[model samples]
Target: MTPRQPEGEALPGAGVLPEQTSAASSSGRERPFSVYLHVPYCRVRCGYCDFNTYTNLAMGGGASAGDYVDTLAGELRLARAAMDRAALPPRAPQTVFVGGGTPTMLPAGDLAGMLTLVRDTWGLAPGAEVTTEANPETVDERYLAALAKAGFTRVSFGMQSAVPHVLRTLDRTHTPARVPQVVAWAREAGLETSLDLIYGTPGETMDDWRRSLETAVEIGPDHLSAYALVIEEGTRMWAQVRRGELPLPTDDDEAAKYELADALLNRAGYEWYEISNWARPGHECVHNQAYWRDWDWWGAGPGAHSHLGDVRLWNTKHPVAWAGRVAAGRLPVAGHEILDAESRELERVMLGIRTREGLELAGLARLGPHGPEPTTAHGTPARLVPVVGRLVGEGLLEGAAAMAGRAVLTLRGRLMADTVTRGLID
Candidate 1:
């Protein structure tokens, strides 16, 4: 089925499909899919954030948020048409994630309208996981109720730390008091709650990290994401550190804090599904899992990315350019690429190693000639065999059925996961 081009429309740039394309399933069978919508506006930019985002870029002076939403709706329509043409069966998206600078920065009505477009175009499945990233300071009773009514089942808040000093150091505006209140309000509104916490800040002590973890557990969020602070190039935080105005923890200290997080959250009944993410049983972020599992998900809005099997496409990063192209009845895509086998294998290892599930031994072997042997038959690599043997000997990793054939990370392994994964992939 070809998408009906609107009157006076022109074809988009190189490699961009014209608002629709044939969707022939590689397996000739229907597959489950997910959707991701990027809301790139934030009330204020955090010093450490490197996401493609605009601060105070709402409806004024050339930045018309209304126009942006309209363009998003157009993109949604094009995406649906593309799927329909592909001959892929019409299945409701298993998950929908609205991540941003801060999705809550948009007016509640505007945000609701965007979600409505998604539901109307893609058709949400019953019990589909719909999540939005919200700021703690933006969570009010009214906004929470509105979001729930709009079909959001999960809400992730950026509560970097529970201490005022830590927050200030992060240049975050919200008070720690707002964390519990937001979680309570979201829970009351019938949405599962998740919180993002940052550890290993310059001045953070073990006690400080412990307090943050304890407070998060006390609030009882369904999910928690604890990330170590990294100073990315071109970020204000990096510049400040270069000038010695701000300091970050050394790698060893950060590793210790990561270990501390594992101890606290695991004791609190949270499972570390991925390196930076934990959740209570059955509360994992389905949308994020889709990415880690390498499932096909459509991304909309500026700087968004989509992958259908091996082909990955991304939209223009500039919101204005994206909207203008869609307004002209063209797909707003900026670039696309079809990944080769080696690239896919590398990506799989990169993503897979970060999760509780290590790389599939058989799949890795099939990827190339240099792949390692299955742990079941030959155990770990020759270089690491002695190390694994010693670790097992010391009672670090359990040799159970769940971990029977895989070199899975133990709680201790998770702390030094990057180093271990590097050795394995190398």
Candidate 2:
């Protein structure tokens, strides 16, 4: 998933497929598709979670692992209906990402079985990238090897902090020592490994942050995602800060931590392919790339979101409600919106500026020259005219790229990406 669509946020478009979408559907295929299955069951709710996840006993309708997969299979049929309605081609998914509520909490066989549903329904494209998010403590050699044999190509472990105090502050249950063991197990099982890290916790100090980064680098995983912790309104972390029991992480503090991570990870041969992600060459998460590059996808599970062509849809938030709706032969869509041209450009700049590729100036008519400008001009979008020059002067944008029809962020610009994007859109 894209960094923007955090666990709870899929709670929030169409573009061309990359020419290779030649799958056989009754309707001629025009674009590629990806599938994301959100397994909303977790062993314990983390302190900072606002995602729609339930504990084993708490899952209503007596939703066991088997029933949930059956429900997902039903939802897959609904997805096919939606695809047929939209005249989308039946191209197999290029990537499949099973996210969680700690997907590994379920038995490994259940995990593998869910992928089987995808394979039978739409089939996996050759060399498809399949990944499942796991809690470090949940998987053992047997479990990971099972996952690998089940066709999982990659596994991402949540290792929030390497410092014990930091882990305690975040209410993480796993010991820091367990991360290496888990990573080793996954590798031995022939699975590629990625580690997720979080910075900007209430009590985390400079050294604490440094220790976490150093520890993660020492593990030699293929990918690393270090996110600045945002206190979602109803989460325990937010409530603690509201009651003054925990200090809030300030902007400067987060900036320092981000810079430290960038320097260290880059030194460790990880490239900053996206604002919040670093990966070794050839190890970038394919599922994430599908999202960032704006391809079509179907999101499954309660409160999951899907984008096909220009229409965006979201499912109901509760597990029981979603299951009931799908069981009743409904699409389980709660609401949807259509993206107009301006809205699409806004999204383009918003998503594109954060990427290493940079945003193309041609589509942004809001930028560039105005007042009866020739349609033939290379960069004459009226709205972008003044802002581009101004940002380049401020050293927030690379001047040469701006002059040459792209908006690549400078180092300082990356530190203040939202502000830079806002200026372009405004």
Candidate 3:
């Protein structure tokens, strides 16, 4: 269940704590939460990217990046102060994740400065997991070592495909050879390493998908995240599809590749802990887990989103606007909504079902009694139960009998998840 603040009291920073509130002592009563920083600058924009990112050209040839960083540091200070006023006791962040257009795009010194700010403002917990996402082309032994020294214990590299043609089609600039070298560099630098892969591209075949999986596993990352390509509107890929320049896979074809990935990765000793994320035991992303479990997390950077208790908020998506607001000594908040109980519950279900831990059955039971086997707009609850049941029968789920008492998806349910979850909650 979502935690509630006392009625008639204003929430911290309008229900979002600033950086100061994130100090080690103010971590609240529960296990300390996580932190996510979005670095919205990229060297080149990919055709498929729908994230809030700007090309390097917009960074003003690196001349304005330092200014942006200074502004970010100032924002952090203000955030810390806001957190303090919120009255949340000091608590060290459990995990810190720096994700991006590409965090590696930042100069090593800039990256170090970001980490230092985090330490000074939030106070990293002892043994805190600090992770940074990088593109393969930008990582090297020197860069990897620098990141390790700066307190990044983990590195996630975008190794979307090992095939050169596929990489070209996706507008990724890295070569297949670059990925393993970077992985080796990261491991030698004493950082846990993970690689991301995308499958079911427009012209990608099942064989190609399998080859990509095999190559990624052979590179030996501690974690892997394989995602099926989604054609998001407003992206270059979507435009290509409209112009008949690319043909997407049929549902059956995509399903075949998904099944192949699951079979291969599971046999290769990776756990499918989430729909798209696979990790070796003890290597699951703690920061991401905080998000899946609905724990409080703070985001800083243009277009970053934060969820604190029942409130969800986002910063200005426009980099210029964000920078201008921060320069003016005001929080760059764009908009926010206080999520109601039902909305929060639904969000928990959607996110939880995507993970291996599934939803907590006991907690769901406490949410309220079943509503005559509640049916969503899509279908009857009874029909949905069997979809879950079949997954358990297939050994993709555990604790099925207990699930009848609580609506949770099995691992197989996670694989064919959209259908089952849509049926349950519409």
lDDT of each: 0.76, 0.81, 0.75
Task: Report the lDDT tens digits of candidate 1 across residue range 1-426.
Answer: 111212222235432443333233334554468999998887777777788788757544223665667778888887776656555467678999999878888777877888788889978888899999999887798999899998889999999899888888888889999999999999999999999999988788888999999999999999999999987777887788889998767988888889899889999999999989999999999888888887778899878888776677777777777777777767777766666767777787677767876654334343236664444453333444554455545444345512353556677766766655565456
lDDT of 1 at 278: 98
TM-score per candidate, chains pooled: 0.86, 0.89, 0.86
Error of 2 at 66 (Å): 3.8
For model 3, how does the per-residue alpha-carbon lDDT over 8-90 read when each residue is reduced to its tens digit? 22334433443333223212445456778888878888998888887753554222555656777877776676667767666
In model 1, the clashing pairs are: 22-86, 23-85, 23-86
lDDT of 2 at 200: 98
Among the numbered candidates, top lDDT falls to 2
Residues forming the 10-long window of minimal summed lDDT in candidate 3: 1-10
